[model samples]
Target: MTQRADVVVVGGGQSGLAAGYHLRRLGVDFVVLDAQSAPGGAWQHTWDSLRLFSPAAHSSLPGRLMPAQQGETYPDAGHVVDYLSDYEKRYELPVQHGAQAQAVRRDGGRFRVETEAGDWSARAVVSATGTWSRPFLPAVPGQDVFTGRRLHTVAYRRPADFAGQRVVVVGGGNSGAQIAADLALAGDVTVTWATQRPPRFLPDDIDGRTLFDVATARRRALDAGRSDTGGVASLGDIVAVPPVRAARDAGLLHAKPMFTRLTATGVQWADGSRSDADAIIWCTGFRPALAHLAPLGLRGPRGHIPTAGTRAVAEPRLHLLGYGDWTGPASATLIGVGRPARDAARDIAQQLSS
Candidate 1:
C-alpha cells in the first residue's frame, strides 16, 4: 500500500519527534517512521549503567521539557526510554513503529520511501536516523586471529556480564572510560583501559548544557565568518560523570597507550609489553545510520550527505536531521535537535505550498 503525506520522516527518534512537533504546529500532513517496535529509539539499546550527561530538566524536546526523576540528578537510560516513550503519545505524533525504511528514491519529482511495512510518498523527506546502529571497530594486527571474545560498544550490556575476566577495553571516548570504570567498580573483572591518545576529562561541573552553549557560540561565529574557538572538541573528551569520577578518584580509570596488536588470548603493546585478557571491548563509536539514503547517492568523501542547514544541497526536497554537526550544530542531542527540526519543517511547509 502506498501512503502519502506532505513530509515523510524516516526516523522516529528525538530528532524525528522534534520535526513532528513543528510540523504539527504548522498543520502539515506528515508521518514518522521508526524501525524499532516501540518508542525510545537508541536509548533502549544502551548499557544498563549508562546515564545522561545532564539533568532531565535541561535535556528535553522542543514542545515539552523532560521531567526530572526523583533521587537522580542525571537519569539512567531507563528514564530516558520512559521519557521518549511518553513523549510521542503526549504530543500525538503520527509515528509508525516497526517501519524500517529500506531505501529512499526520487519519484515524480517527489520522494518514495520503501520500508518494511509499505511505501510512503512525500513532497519532502526527513532522514533523522541517528548513529547508534553502526558501531565502528578499527582493524588491528592479529585482530582476526584473536581467540578471545571481541565486541563493540553496541554489543556491550552490563559490566557484570564480564565478571571474573581480564578485559581490555579500547578507545579513549566516553564509552571506553565509562565501561572500564563500570567493570572495575561493579564487575569482578580486571580491566586494562587502552587509548590511542590519553583521554581528556572535562571539568566536573561541565555537562550537556554547557556543551550546547559552546556549540551555539561556535555556530554563531562560523555563520558570522569570524575566527571561532573550537566547540565541544576544545573542552575535552570525557565529561566526568558520577561513575567515571568515582572510578577515577578510586584510581581505577588509568588509561594506557593502545596495544599494537591482538594476540591469541589478549593484546600486545609496542614496547613488547602484553596483557592477558578473556575479552576485548571496542568502544570506538559509530557512523551516522543513513544506509536507507544510499539510493540517493549524495554522500561525500567524509561519508556524510552535504546539506545547507538541514536541507540536502543537491535535493532540496530531502532534508537530513539529527546526524550531528554536519546537519546542524548539536543537532544529534535531544535538546539541540529542536531548532533544526523546526527549520526543516518550516522549509518543507514553504516548499509544499510553493
Candidate 2:
C-alpha cells in the first residue's frame, strides 16, 4: 500500500524525533522512516563506554525533561538510548521502523521515497540520517596486504576485545584515544595512536562547573550571536583533547604523528617509524549517507550534501539536520537536537501551507 503525507522524515535519530514531535504538534500529516529497528542512530552502534560530554541539564530534548542523574558526569551510550526510546513513547509519535529508504526520486510535483517495504509519497522530506551513517576509512596503501585483525571505531565495543594484543589505533579523535587507553589499562595491551593533527587539551573543570558545562555555555553564547569568551574552543574538540592527554600521561598509549602505509605485518609512519601490532583500529570519521539520494543532485564536494542556508540544499521540499552548526552545536548534539528540528518543522510547515 502506498502511504501519503505532507512530509517523510528519514532517519530515526534525535533530530528526526524532534522533527516528528514538532510536526505532529503543528497538525501536519507526516510519517517518520528509520533504517534502524530502534531509535538512537549512532548511539546504538558506538563504543560500549561512550558518553556525552554535555551535562544532563543542557542535553534534554524538546518537551521533555532530562532524567535526573547523580552527578554532573556525562551520560553513557545506553542512558542516551533509553532517553530517546522514552521520548518517542512520550510523544506517541508514529515511526516506521526497519523501513530504510533505499532511493528517493522526484515524480512531477511530489517526491517518491522507495523503501524496502514499499513506496511512499510526500510533499517534503527531511534527511536526518546524520554524518555518522557512513564511516570514512581512507585507503591506506597496502591495506589489503595486512595480515592482522582490523576494526573500525564502529565495530569496537569494549577494550577487553583486544586483550593481550598489540593494538594500533589509527586516528586523532577522542574515540581513538579512549579506545587505546582502555585497552592498554584494562587488558595491558600495547597501544599506539596516530593522527595528522596534534590535539589541544583543556582542564576538566573551571569555576566550580565541569568543562562540559562551560563548553555548552560557550556554544549557547555563540548561537545567540554574542561574542565568545575567547579562551575556549568548541566542545567537541575540547572533549576529544583531554582524554587523549590523559591516556598519554598514563602511559596507556603513545601518540604518533601520522600513518604512512600498511605493511603485510604492521604499519609504517611518515617519520619513518614502524610498529608491530596484532590489531588496527580506524577511528577516522564518517560521511553523510546520501548514496540513496542521488536523484536530488545535492552533493557538493567530498560526497557531502550541500545545504542552502541550513534549511534546504539544492532541492526543494528537502531539509537537512545536524549538518554542523546549521543551528549550532546545541542542536547538533544527541541531547540538544531539538532546536533545528523545531526550525525544520516550522519552515516545512510554511512551505506546505503556501
Best by TM-score: 1
Q: lDDT for every model?
A: 0.92, 0.75
Residue-wise C-alpha lDDT for candidate 2, range 243-291, written one tens digit per residue: 4456667766667787789888889887877788899999887776777
Q: What's model 1's TM-score?
A: 0.99
Q: Which 10-residue span in candidate 2 carries the lowest summed lDDT?
A: 204-213
Best by lDDT: 1
Clash-forming residue pairs, model 2: none
Q: How do all models score by TM-score?
A: 0.99, 0.88
Model 1, poorest ten-residue lDDT window? 297-306
What's every prediction's RMSD, in angstroms?
A: 0.8, 3.4
